[model samples]
Structures are given as structure tokens and as C-alpha cells.
Target: MNPHNARIEHHPVLGTLPPRKTIRFRFDEMIYEAKEGETVAAALLANGVRTLRLQEEKGTPRGFYCNIGHCFECRVTVNGKQGTRACLTLVEDMMEVISGKPFSSPLKKGGNHA
Candidate 1:
């Protein structure tokens, strides 16, 4: 193996990547500006919203592990609902997002409602 040959990929789907655009979203009561074509989860992660979900046991911090939706780690409330796959959701201006307890977090860190 050639150590010097190693190259890091910015995206898993390298090549033919589309240009990013600007979009807006509302998490809780605050609005956030993000790029278009970016996954809701990805944008959230980039915006420092690492704590996405709440732990069922004691409201511990839960964050995304897999960018893919199969992990269910990025599950969040979208437009007032539960089981939303943030990684799969696209950003649309005025989109509403919430974290914890399907709408309210018993241990919400940022005052997010259930």
C-alpha cells in the first residue's frame, strides 16, 4: 500500500456533485439559513446542532451516527411530527423542525418543544 497515494473524499458520492444553494429552516422558534441540496441532518450538523434527539431514559444527548437514514439516529420531529428522517429530508424555506418526545423534550438543552 502506498501511504502517499491516500486521498480523502469530501463526499461519498464523489464526482458530479451539484452546487449548493441557500435555504432556510425553522427549528423550534429560531430560523436558520442553510444550503440547498443539503440534508436536514447535514445542515443541522454544520450549524452546530449536534444534539438532535433525546435519550428515552434520561434526556441524554443523542446525535447522528450514520448520515444514512437506516440508523434512525437522526430521527427528529418535522412540521410537528415524529419519526422524521432528517438525513433524508430536504431543506425548504419555512420548514419547521423540532427535537425530542415527538415534540417536547423532557430534558431539552435548547428549549425545544415536544
Candidate 2:
């Protein structure tokens, strides 16, 4: 599927939507287009990007389970800020989002527990 044309033009509840302002943002170093009012998760999902991040220890792939802010499964890095929830954050033009980075535990193995 073409990522550029991956938006839902019509909704069953909302009906046809008027054209929204298009903005550009970067995800994992790739540029993508999103509507002005779209959230980071919405924009990424519309572009066919399902895998948002990797599990901290297992490295398992993770995506948006609960679209609402309740579940933090959609957390990602935005503009150098770590642990930013994509589902709640709005997408801004020229915004940079990074995901799927290798996990590094704060406490080292056999380290002292102060």
C-alpha cells in the first residue's frame, strides 16, 4: 500500500471530511505527510506504520494497543524527548520522531542497589 495515500478520506460517523492542511514530519529518519490536526499515532498509522517501538528487554515489536492516553504502548521519542506518547501528542510540521531503539536498562547487572 502506498503510504502517501493511506489516509481515510471518509468516515462512517463523520462522513466526508474537508481537506486539511498538510504538514511534513520525520519518523525514523523518513519524511511523511500528515493533516494539521492529526496526532503522531494517527499520522503514523495512516502512513502504514504499525510498529511504533520495541519492547525494552525482549526487543519485541510494539504498536498502539489502546489509542487513548491510558495505555502507553504507543510511546516514542519526539524531538529528543524520550517516552513521549504518540497517541496523545499532535504532529507538528518538521517534527522528528524516533522509535525502535535498542533498550538500555538503567541498572546494570550485579550493580549496587543504593
Candidate 3:
């Protein structure tokens, strides 16, 4: 576990969270450990990885602003796919996470979904 991780080690109401199976994954070329069933955002946060992506225009740093999937603040590249929502995507062993400038979006080129 990261020394500066922000994950909830102990909850006031639920007490300590039970240990879960561990998995190894990579984020921006660095390996990180995460619970098998946990979300990519949760795993990144647990490992002190705050900057999930950067603004395309100015390259401003962004991270987990909203825990849910609404904010789009935690968007990242998973494997070779871009615009993957980290908060809703489950972590898998050996998964590759690319953050910041490497992350891309189809909308950036005014592409239409339909």
C-alpha cells in the first residue's frame, strides 16, 4: 500500500474494510497494486495517483473530482482504448493505464457518435 494513499482504511460506521484479493496493474508505466474487484479510479487513488488525465487544450492536470461517472474528471486510457471512465471501469491484472497527454477522445475532432 502506498504510504500517502487516500483510500479509506477504516470507516467510522463499517469499521475496517475486509482485505480483498490483490492484483497488479500499470499506470503511466508504473506498477500498482489494487484489489481485484475494485475500480481503476479507486486503485489509482489508493496508490497516491491523483492525476488521471490532463486537459487537452492547456495540459492542465485533472483527477478524481467526482467518485461517480458524471464528472469525466477521471477519464483515462485503458489498454489501447481512449476515454475510459476510470471510476466505473474495474481493475484487471496487467491492465495498462495511460494518463495525462496520452489520453485522447473522439470528440476532440468533432466526431459524432451516430
TM-score of each: 0.69, 0.85, 0.82
Task: State which candidate, 1 or 3, has the greater TM-score.
Answer: 3
Question: Residue 47 error for model 2, in Å?
Answer: 0.4
lDDT digits (tens) for residues 19-39 of candidate 3: 888899999889998988899
Using alpha carbons, what is the TM-score of model 2? 0.85
Question: What number of backbone clashes does candidate 1 have, counting pairs of residues 3 or more apart or in separate chains?
Answer: 5
Better of 1 and 2 by lDDT: 2
Model 2 misplacement above 4 A: 1-4, 105-114
Which is the better candidate, 2 or 3, if ranked by lDDT?
A: 2
Residue pairs in clash, model 1: 21-36, 103-113, 103-114, 104-113, 104-114
Write down the worst ten-residue block by lDDT for model 2. 1-10
lDDT of 1 by residue, 12-76 (tens): 66764455666789886777767777778877866668888777656677888888878887788
**Model 2 per-residue lDDT tens digits across residues 1-114:** 344567888999999999899999999989998899999999999988999999997689999999999988998999999999999999999999999665787867788969
Clashes of each: 5, 0, 0
Which prediction has more favorable lDDT, 1 or 3? 3
The alpha-carbon lDDT assigned to residue 21 of candidate 1 equals: 65
Question: For candidate 3, what is the lDDT?
Answer: 0.86
Score candidate 3 by TM-score against the native: 0.82
Q: Rank the candidates by TM-score, best first.
A: 2, 3, 1
